[model samples]
Target: MDVTQVLRMNGGDGDYSYSNNSLLQRKVISMTKPIIEEALTKLYCAMNFPKTLVMADLGCSSGPNTLLVASEIIKSIDKIRLELGHDKPPEIQLYLNDLPNNDFNTIFHSVSTLQKIITNPSCYFCGVPGSFYTRLFLNKSIYFVHSSYSLMWLSQVPEMAISNKRNIYMSKTSPPSVIRAYYEQFQRDFSTFLKCRAEEMVSGGRMVLTLLGRQSDDPCSKECCYIWDLLAETLNDMVVEGLIDEEKLDSFNIPQYTPSHNEINNEVKKDGSFIVDHLEVSEVKWDACTGYNHNLSEKDTQGYNMGKCMRAVAEPLVLNHFGESVVEEVFTRYTNVIKNRMSIEDTKLVNVTVSMTRKG
Candidate 1:
């Protein structure tokens, strides 16, 4: 299956749409604000505050979080411009980029609201429909780049990853070859990403990228691996119940990999086009967006909300593979699995934030 054609967050403004359920991603964008500020500040100075700042938010799924990143960038640079007492703010030409199937209409329609929120720097918004794994802009055109909760998705699932069998993602039971395939796929995709961005961004261009990541070198660490593990277990349960085919369970694998901080570092070094300026790992609770109470009684609510969050992001891919018939039931059971696990341990996600500059 061509991942570019099928993979996208649930769109529109309904209950399960990414626009409504993306608080987790919004929190991630918020967490990376300081880094964004610092990167843009230096880039603005390095470029002598160009008249027009060209920027792109890669993998910008539709939602409040879509424009939230733009607002952050504008606010960060606008603050610096004001502090320096510059009479004019740069006109910001921002591109919102994602796969072709993303809800670009929602994003375009929301710009009026964004205009009310941003006063200066006259931002022009346009949606670029394509994969970030390939070139999406003119050479040396973009001055700044930002991506959040996106890079962990590989361009495609590694062919050998299906050999992982029963498990949907990297787990303790995955053999060495499956683990190696995932990492190798990540290395290739990340290097290609860096190479593409390097050509598109001008010298001294700055970028801030935040993605789901792992703290431990072990690819199977719970922080990054458990979400998929739980979903796989849920699928296995369904197979036993005769709700889903066992062979179908064996064939499906999430086209994502959460890398260690050092893995990110190694990819940057190997890519050779960007100099890593800052790299850090931070952890947030799985249910960070929901005001979820940990009381035993509140478990069901937490489970329901968690399932909605995951489904909002995963539904399209899941629907494409498993069909709509099982989507609700799948997440319904998956939530119970998560709720049960919550009773035993706290669930958290590890995020890796990297700030970089294009080599002149």
Candidate 2:
């Protein structure tokens, strides 16, 4: 199947929209706010308050986080202008980018609200639809770039990944070949990303990228795919229940990679377009965004909360692969699997924050 054509966060504000299930992503964005503000602050100070601030947020899905981030950026710029007592803040030209199928209508609807929130009346918002692996704007047009929890997705599933049977992501049990395939895909995708941004950004422009990544250098570490492993087991259960064909399950592998610091730094060095200013690896609990519910059992709470987050981000790809009928069964099964593992207190996902500056 064509991964690019099918990959999207569930659209709209309905039950299945990524707008509803994106608590985890929103948490990650909140976690990185200070870093984002710091990066943009440094850029403004370094550039001596350029007259026009051109910024882009790649893979910006339609939701609260979308405008929240852009609004935060505009707010920062206005704050800097106030602190420095400049005659005026730069004209903020903001670009929100995502795939063609993203729920852009939802985002565009908030343009006026976003403008009203910004301290500066000059902030302008525009939605650019396309993949980030290619050029999305003119050369040196952007002065700052931000992407959150999005770079880990590969442009396409690797042909070699078909060997990772019955699993939707890389796991410890995956063969050496399967692991290498994932690493190579990440390398290619990230390198290409740097190349594109290098041309699109000004010489001193700053970029901050937050990816779901791991602390360990081992690509096979459970840190990378343990939750996915739980989901895989649920799929197996469905197959046993005659709800799904085992053959159908084997063909699906999610095109995502959780890279380690070493892998990310390696690609940045090879790309030679940016100097890495900061790289931090932090841990976030699996239930960080899943608030406690007194009405349900621990199992149900864990299952339902995690299920919503997973279903929101995963429904599009899963729906395309398994079709409409099985969507309910698969995620319901996935939730039960989460509930079964409620005793594992150490479950957390690693978040990587990398900030860089474009080289001359």
Candidate 3:
């Protein structure tokens, strides 16, 4: 499966679309707001009062939170400019980037909405469609970059792990070779991302990246990757019931890797282009919202809510591999499996938020 083609949040503003089901993502954006505010404020203060500021939001899935991020940054810059005794806002060339198949139309149509969000309304919105694994802008064009919950995805599944049948990601039962392959892919992809961004960003440019990550040092730690384990088990159940072929399940693996905090710092150090300003680990519960809420409610069971949340992100991949008919059943089983075994405590998905700046 083409990760770039199929890996997108559920489209549109409908009930099941990412915009509707992205409360968890919104919570994450909110959780990182302080860091964003501080970083942008500092960046503005550090720079000369230029007339235009170039900014890009990578992996900006079409959702309500997309423009909200831009608006928040605009507000930060406004306050900073006021403090610096500038009466006018800088012209911001705001770029929202995602995979090509992502619902760019939905985000593109929201430019009018953006005018209302920013204080000065001086930002020019541009939708740049592509993967963040490669460069999207001219050399030294961007002044600030932001990505959240998106960098966990690799550019592709590790080719060497094709023999890793019956597992979509590293599991407790996975062989050492399989584990190394996933780690190495993340290293390569992340290093390339930094190298490209280093060229695209001006000297002293800023980047704030928030992604799913492992809390433990071990890449194979269960806490870091238990969600995929439950997902694989759900597919295994379907295989037993003849709903999906085992070979199909084996062939399909999520092109995602959640690295440890140490690994993230190491990548920045290895890239030698950016200096890490701050790196933090924040734990978010699996059932972060109503659909994935821990307690079973009268309207939606824990399984049902978790199923919907999982569907929002995984539906595209599931549709490509198992067909549309199997999507609902698989997530139903996914939710049931989680409800039956994993408790509330096991649901913490660690988020690593790192703030960095290009070295002069």
Candidate 4:
């Protein structure tokens, strides 16, 4: 599918109440703030002089997480200014960017709520709508760049792999060819993303990125907390039910790039532009105590209530495959499967957060 179609497929003002919940994302924001703040301090110290700082958050989806990141940057700058006792700190130009179809209205509303705290009229806020794989800012302008839970979505898979009709991504068994194709596309998009950002960032600028990743090499293996097997099983059931065409299934992929720490280090080295300053993988766990609690263990009525929370991501993909008419039934069966599985013990949702920074 083309970019426009892909956006349309994923676009909608569904019940994204969970995505906006601050409580759940707060933990993540708090955990990542120290690392980002440290990077900023190092960058400023290296410059050895006060200067205008331009920061951009690539793929900043409309949610509390976006604002949380922006607030962290502002606070860090404030702390630095106080330490040096500067009468006036350098200006801050903050850019929030995402796909063109993102909910800019919600994002703007969130920004407005912060107007009281971000009192400086010199502090600028702008919305940049575009793909991060391509250019998003002017050359030699940005001082810091950060992205979270983004980057894993590639622009598109390799064309050759799609044309081969190998069904590498979705077959009765594991398909290494499909896995390799996905990796190649990730590498290309990631490389382009770095190059584009490099052009916009000053020579001494720093970048901190966090995204979903895996530490294993097995295509079907488990890592951190993401269970590909469960997801595959869910999709396979749909295929068997004739709700979606098996051929079309291979046409689209999640495009998640779960690179190992070493692989990521190597990619940075190959780029010959950014120096790897910090690379660490940590487990991000989601549990019942989190916001918008959804699981199979809930009673049928309670589970349905929680299942409504998942429509944001599921509805689009399901609608694209099986007409919109089947959404209710599809979701019903899907949720039922979860409820059934919950009877078993030891099931949890987990993700890996890979944090990296560029040389300043």
Candidate 5:
């Protein structure tokens, strides 16, 4: 699906307005800042001489978190300058990239707000809007690349998997053919992404990417939760109730692209463009319950709203089979299901961040 088509189908900016709320965005920024800082330090160490550095945040959505990455990079550069006792700061260029349909208005406004707070004279900022899976940066030009909560989205799912005879992904049981198709597509997209980055990044440059991932090597294992199923079922329910077209529900399929750690490593190794430096997986716990209800205690509401808001933003893709009028209702049902599931004490989500360095 085209990014712009998806955004337009969901009411564009109106559907995405909630993403800019400060309270919701802080959670993402807090989780992501340290990862970016560590990557920047490594990149700085790898640089042979001080020159203008180009950094891009691929798939950076419209929110405070987008600018937070830029701010953290600038701060790390300043820290390096201070430690080296240099009179002038290092020249830096920052690129904030997302799909063409992203809320650039909010992003530009956030950039304006950030400019007032950042006093560095050598920093330059620009927005590069496009799909990362296709092409993002100029060839052999980027010095550092960072993408979080992106890359997991494939350009599109394979056609064979959606056929009626197969119907593998739609089934509740873990179908081997379906799982293999998904893995193959992920490998293709990820390899393309790495090859493109390999062409764009300078030798010895560093890249850090973080996204929602599963821990299992087995493709059919339940360890990886397919979130689209929940949304699909929700839309299916609406169809049964005559709220949506059954044919639309039948025709729609979730866009596939979640790779296990082993899958990612194998693809990276096969590409032979980047050396894997760090691979870490952390189980992130989120309170989906606190988001829909403001009556919950502030202390209990520790960034659950951010996850909820992300779910809301992604609901369009999940509910694309349904009519636009039922979009909100479908998301409400999905959120309620998530909240109920999260009520269990052991419920949590897993997030993985992988860092790679360009081979010289």
Candidate 6:
């Protein structure tokens, strides 16, 4: 599968669309706001107050959270300008980037809504469609960059010599060779991503990246593997019941990897283009809302809610592999699996947030 063409969140504002079911992603954006503010503040001071600020939001899936991020950045910069008593506000050029298949229409159509929230006439928006793995901006053109919940997706699924055997991602049963293959693929993709960004960003430009990661060094840890394990389990059950082909189940693998902090740091140091400012790992509840309350509810609908969330991100891939006939049934069984698992024990996803500065 072409990761650039096939890997995208379900678009539009329907009930199962990413725009509606992206509460989890939206929550992630909120969690990283402080990191973004800190990076922007430092960049503003270090750059001697440039008249124009060029920034890009990579992997900006079509959703309310897309503009929400832009609004937050504009608000923070506006606040900083006012505090510093700048007579002229800087013109902000934000490039919202994603794959070509992304619903750019929805994003462009929502500009008025963003205007209602932040009526900054100086702020301008543009849509750049392509893979972030390749260069999207001119050399030394960008002043700041932010990406949330995107880098976890590799450029493509690793080419494995041996079949992963019914598992859609790394698991305890996966062989050492399989694990090595996944890690090596990430190393290449991430290094290329860094090289491209290093060329695009100006010296001392700041970047804030937040992505799903594992707390332990083990790639098969529950923090990163459980979700896909449950998904594979559901598919296995379907195969047993003759609902899906056994060979197909054995062949399917997700083009995603959750790296540990050590792994990420190694890549950054190896790339030799950026200096790490801050790196942290935080836990977010699987179905937790973005409010003061942190408790997981026992609501019966939580299972379906989580199912929809997963569907929003994974449906397109599933449809491409298994056909649309089995999409609903697959997620239905997956939801029941999540509900049962939640009843037994609370589950959480680990998120890694990192801030970096381009080396001068």
- lDDT tens digits, residue span 313-334, model 6: 9999999999999999999999
Q: What are the Cα lDDT values of the candidates?
A: 0.89, 0.85, 0.85, 0.63, 0.67, 0.91
Residue 104 error for model 3, in Å? Answer: 0.8
- Report the candidate with higher lDDT, 1 versus 6: 6
lDDT of 3 by residue, 263-298 (tens): 999999999999999999998765665553456563
**Candidate achieving the largest lDDT:** 6
Off by over 4 Å in 3: 291-303, 341-346
RMSD of each: 1.9, 1.6, 2.2, 3.8, 3.4, 2.4
Ranking by TM-score: 6, 1, 2, 3, 5, 4
**Model 4: per-residue Cα lDDT over 165-252, one tens digit each:** 3232323354556667766887898889888887888887888877666566553445522333444455567778986677765554
Comparing 2 and 5 on TM-score, the stronger one: 2
**234 in model 1: Cα distance from truth in Å?**
0.6
TM-score of each model, in listed order: 0.96, 0.96, 0.94, 0.83, 0.86, 0.97
lDDT of 6 at 259: 96
Return the number of clashes found in candidate 2. 0
lDDT by residue for model 1 (148-253), tens: 9989999998879347778888899998999989899998899999999999999999989998998898998888999889899989999999999988888888
Instruction: Summarize candidate 5's per-residue lDDT along 28-86 as a digit string, tens digits.
Output: 45676677677777777778546689989887876666777788878877887677677
Show model 6 residue runs off by greater than 4 Å.
289-298
